[model samples]
Target: MNHEVIGGIPVLWADAPGPLEAVLMFGCGVQDETLRTLGTTHMVEHLAMSTLPRLHHEHNASVDLLTTQFTCTGRPEQVVAFLAAVCEALTALPLERIEQEAGVLAAEDGRVADPATAELLSHRYGVQGLGLAAYRGPGADRIPVEAVQEAVDRFFHRGNAVLVLTGPPPADLRLPLPDGERPDRSAALPVLRTGPSWREEDVPGPGLALHGDLDDPALQLACKLLSQRLRDTVRHRHGLSYDVGGDAVLAGPGHGERTLCLDAREGQEQRVAELLWEEALRLARECPTEDELAEEIAELREVYQDPRSTTCELGEAAGALLFGGTYQDPQTRLAVLEKVTPDEVRQAFAAALETVLLVVPCGTEVDPKLPDGRPLPRRACGTEGELPPGAKVFRPPLVDRLRSSDARRARLAVDGRGLWAREPDGTVHHVPFTEVVGVEMRGPGRVVFGRDTCVIPVVPELWAGIGPAVDAVDAAVPGQLRYPASAFRPAD
Candidate 1:
């Protein structure tokens, strides 16, 4: 089987294989958000699959504008069929009708929320353009569903595709046409990343959630290190948090750079902020112990060194190949991983001295100190123990008070949908597709999708007396999810 292909396209066939797993990935780099809004790349992906005339395929794809990448991963037999379909769909989606898919494209193009996500992201990216919220990391993270759907319509085009294929093709697969080529691209690739800086906001909580932004090339590696150290020093060493975790958030759809994200229990916001700064200083000045250093290096090596032993991994490799042309070959990845050293990691850590945004959300009632050593203000509760007018409330998901280490259970009836669950605290999980997983029900008749199962949870209703949005991401796993409501409505 061949691993390298000219023009970032390849074919592999093996004679000894019994049932080879075939993978094909396609990628296109995106440079601007306007193209993302145009929906050219998305239409191409959707239509490509439609053209697969004979094969049943399963794949994953995302339209990333930050790096201008559109990736498709699927089987070899279907891929050839896919490309053909895309070529046809570009001119075929009936662009002439404003009544057709064109409107969908327009709707998606209009869905942009210029919010703190970007402001916070900018802190990590520093001056680098990678932090633009319109183009990075699941561009739909906080977007409306209608807008995300529309972005899909405008991306069906010719210029935004990077065809990548890997593994041995099944013998029955055939390629009949002479290879057609897309135009070659130019140099001047913008290096991705942000220099560190701080962005902060307060959340209603007894504890502060400190999240650091990444603008460093070595951010992915830095995240693994800092999170472990911070956990040991702030959360573990002193037992401040109930739980804590740190992860590197990649910004682009294909090969975007990384940012560090983390959450910890509340109460020591001021102390935690100081610890964060001190830890950054410590990482830059004090070298890690040899044992601590070697362990992290080994972990990095495993990400690529692990053999492709399953269809899932192959599918993942295929996705990376198709979407990020930069990572088209498994061997190259393995080779790169094998060559990493400890000194390189230390060097990356030392260089990340610039302070990034430190967002800490502490419950206002906690009397926690801010980084500058100021007391937190009391967050207000709109109303207690109340339901919206004309809404029926089934009891049990809520508890007035409970001793720590206690359990409670209840069933809720909203617009005829029954949601049952247990809560360690008064927090609720935003279940997908219920009139009200927490409150509204996509019910028999919701504001939209009357009976549709795409229930959007009432965005953080009341848990105890504090608005739940403040504790949205950090709560007990919801044992129940209902397919109900489609929009956010405040609890009256």
Candidate 2:
């Protein structure tokens, strides 16, 4: 493992499977102007890298609050050539173009979701101040393109940033970054704040209305666990809302604070709030014993292992290095989790859920008695909306194909393992089918595939990363079957 900083950019060149996948560049720092131009700078990157004329079959790029990553890979020197172009675009990127991009992002920021499932988002992230009220409309003045352009110009500077170039760096790979102090644009790590914030609104849905704003530091992990348990209990077992998972959102770069949210069955809307509180309380009151924690931990580890390093790991690595500002080595990172204790886990859980903000999303059948029985507000989908409403029929075969992929979504926890494919709708597919070898959950919800097993953070997004996912049945097999999100049922 050889590591060095090129042009002040941290670079890690390592030996990997033939035909390298990507050279990920992670750019993240706390800055003021960066927060402002964050959207604009990303817009510039999109225009430059995405539209490269020599692109072969596929290319992808995205920007998050923490970083913006562009991964262009192909045969031999082709990827390196593309890499040079990417660096040029990144270093000499036009501020004007970034400004334009900012406009595009502002438009996205201006979206007001008025869907039947609108309550779902509200209960999940909305009221906790984790709301997603974008002001992307033409008339919407706040968060406009100009504002973002300014921020972009002010952000993205040299710091402890890293640029990981694996496989090969073309003979000619250069960018225009003079080594020096990095400007500050992002915010600082959050200091613990006590108590919860609550809001009321009308929700439209079919089951109970559950609302909560979890303010604890463990909010992120809590979000994943609750979402998993929600799918397990509320959706699968109890049959609550059409969708029954909530979340916690740490604040954006410079504005706002972290939050938590939840929503449930329309009819049970009133009790939904109580349910969330009760669930959180129960977890705290009866914290997972070492045995219970170990079981759950095993399940989590099993989920993180990926067998092959093809399909997804490149994207993930590229994304993390580019946006997360840190390298994610599955084998090494999982080692850290193994050291966590039941006390640490339980204490973290108790601290995060106490005193949080809560929101609830409901269906058309207006619930009059919200937990506070304060009639919740109704958010409508203005005639013109981004996507069409009403439950769109999910094509099962398309989803199954993705699930059946042998590509690695993440590097395996213990090397030589991988994860299953995930669809756009956030569904986890069963890795091994009937003919193929299936992995079992050694404990709790854990699953074992091949020789490796690891705990996977069950939230759909994290589920996408099961270490490095790989499948060996070359030559595409008939992918016509469909499976449910939770297919670990008892077999007779």
Candidate 3:
């Protein structure tokens, strides 16, 4: 593939001389949105793609952790025209169909609820930044056209984008986008805990999930070897599990996580957990054999040797350029693979053990026999300072407040320094003002406090004089910290 710049946008093209597959990617997605504005990027994606005409090409739009892309597969000319239309649609977004598009987004969310994956991420990272998947979809009905417009203006521009063509570049390909600076990655959202944590959810059956940083190629190989061991022992040998695999979440440079997963039969919970640790502990203590490493390396080489490998690598290469990541071509990756010794894999596995987060079936009992697991805390972590004055405190059963039959009733006090929610039994949770990175209004009556630990929801109707108190809190926070409520609301 060759690299060039067109109309101030980076372009990567390969002369494959076949049907074309092209993608235009922007460095924006769910990570760029807030809890209140949760689906803004996605909404904008749908709105932009909605404007494209029906061409004889396969086209679609997707929003992932850190990038939103519109891709098309067809003849070179058709692909180019589709992309141009996509860019034009993005420039002048159609806000009139926002409500219609939101309905579609809400339906999409309902169809793909992989609780196992979502629970693992939420438990590991909390409901901020990349962890938004663990929570409900953004109140789509509450999103407004103005918010969608702002997202397009801020993130969809020439400087923050790239276009990749796998077959051939179209003649006179032009992208008339407005001038804008490349936007950096969004701020890191705060989590309840950064240390190793554990959570149990009521999933369909038993499973084990683990995640850690991508520090080295050896570490990546270790994850694969570990998954293989689990599958062999638990599935082939014992018939305990049907599926086991490992995946990498390479959002950008230095920011990546390897996830190891295993799904088991109904009564194999304990056995699966035991086998998972047995393999993981074994890998951490001893490196794989030369034969094993050679086999894995051969498989990696085969992937790159495929006829369609260059086309596959094109998108990843373009994404790496936009994300400040290291883009190793097939040859470079092979070179790196050769340098990875079995001993290095062992050491990487050992280090990964330090920051592991585990997710297990809620009702199942299993003991990997590691350190004692700490249950997720109810309040914020590391918050300090006395509560501010003019605070409005509200208890449960407040007007329009959603609650369960046995939900813990507490007093939520909002002040300048921060907000605190204390249980009736004197258990207190405080979110300091300094820790507040952003604030957002979810609805006309609901306010969310974006803190380092969690998103604290407060209902104004639940507290007296909430308007004045919130006004003061807004003054204490930065203007960019808040998002105005959208105009639309879902029907009952």
Best by lDDT: 3
Clash pairs detected, candidate 3: none
lDDT tens digits, residue span 289-375, model 2: 556545555665665563344334444454334333344565564565556665555556555444333444433232332233333
Per-residue alpha-carbon lDDT of model 3 for 1-492, expressed as tens digits?
Answer: 799898899999876646788889998877667655678888888998889776766888898877898898887678878888988998988888987998887768631125566555555555566666655543676665677888988989998999998855778788878888887643334444444544556554333344454547888788878877777788999999888866665534555556777787987776786677678778877879988888788988899888677767887887778777667788888888778999999988777766566667765665554433434232223244433466766556534345542234556777667777655445566666676655656454445554343555555545534565466567776665566554443422
Candidate lDDT (C-alpha), each: 0.38, 0.40, 0.69
- What is candidate 1's TM-score against the reference? 0.47
Q: Quantify how close model 2 is to the true structure by its C-alpha RMSD in Å.
A: 22.1
Q: Which ten residues in a row have the lowest lDDT in candidate 3?
A: 373-382
TM-scores of the candidates are: 0.47, 0.53, 0.80
Cα lDDT tens digits for candidate 1, 2-116: 3444323444333332233433333342332321123344433443344445545644444443323223345545655554454454444432332333334434543221233
| Candidate 1 lDDT for residue 256 | 34
Residue 419, candidate 3: how far off, in angstroms?
A: 5.0
Model 3 ranges off by over 4 Å:
15-18, 110-114, 185-194, 202-215, 267-270, 371-492
Candidate with the larger lDDT of 1 and 3: 3
